[model samples]
Target: MSNLTRTQEKELKEAFDIFDRDHSGSISARELKAVFKNLEISASDQDIKNAMKQMDINNDGEISFSEFSRVMEAQFYRKYTHEEIRAAFDHFDKDKSGYISADELRMTLSKMGKTFRKDEVDKMIKSIDKDGDGRISINEFMDLLN
Candidate 1:
């Protein structure tokens, strides 16, 4: 009953395989960023820096594929339930319009204690605004969640 299909799980494993460049079982900061870039996902420079700091459990500035996989799997598992996903979308739909608008995104992020400049939020919205819509549909929101 998990939301993750077998193909999706396999793809995740494949991604982990490709990102483990050195075969040392560890992905360096550069490696993780490379994967993100390849996926066409842009994080703010500070976001990447913060992620590296937190995800590199040993403070070594490097994350093992096992470590990365563990985090990803935990996140994936947590949202395996349909209700969990629906609840998350509900949280993102700030206006209660059943969709996520830029203001909604900004407000939700701000409520989470993230301080993003208006322009920065705009830039982020531009990047994730799939389908050229000004707002994110539930499907788009789910994609971003992943």
Candidate 2:
């Protein structure tokens, strides 16, 4: 099972609640269709049914919190293509240094309007910096994403 951080879990729960209309504590097919419609994604009845079947771990024809969290968590950590990883790495390496320093990460997050403390940024860098080089190389970033 995927272990989600508290923040992630909260976000996922919020999303699930948005989709679970009627205060049913579960996502019905009609509610799922409404969600797709709100997202402007075209989904047929069969498509919705198939998705419900895949996410309804207990085969109950609906998605409970546990099932919704599991499916959403898997989607959250889905692998990225090499090109996507390279593009992200390029965006983070503002100095063109081929490696992302903790300061760069902080600045990037700031630009995106997401703030983190120095220790949090350091922890993030440490998690992705496989070489313990105090920075994130392209390879290290790719490995972390994949």
Predicted model with the maximum TM-score: 2
List of clashing residue pairs for candidate 2: none
| lDDT score for residue 11 of model 1 | 58
* Best candidate, lDDT: 2
Alpha-carbon RMSD of each model:
11.1, 7.8
How many angstroms is residue 88 displaced in model 2 relative to the true structure, after the best TM-score fit?
Answer: 16
**Clash numbers, per candidate:** 0, 0
lDDT of 2 at 45: 94
Cα lDDT computed for each candidate against the true fold? 0.70, 0.85
| Tens digit of per-residue lDDT, candidate 2, span 1-146 | 65888888997887787787677999999999976775455899999999999999998888999999877898668888999899888878989999999999998766543568999999999988888989999999888778
> What TM-score does candidate 2 reach?
0.54
Model 2 worst lDDT window (10 residues): 107-116
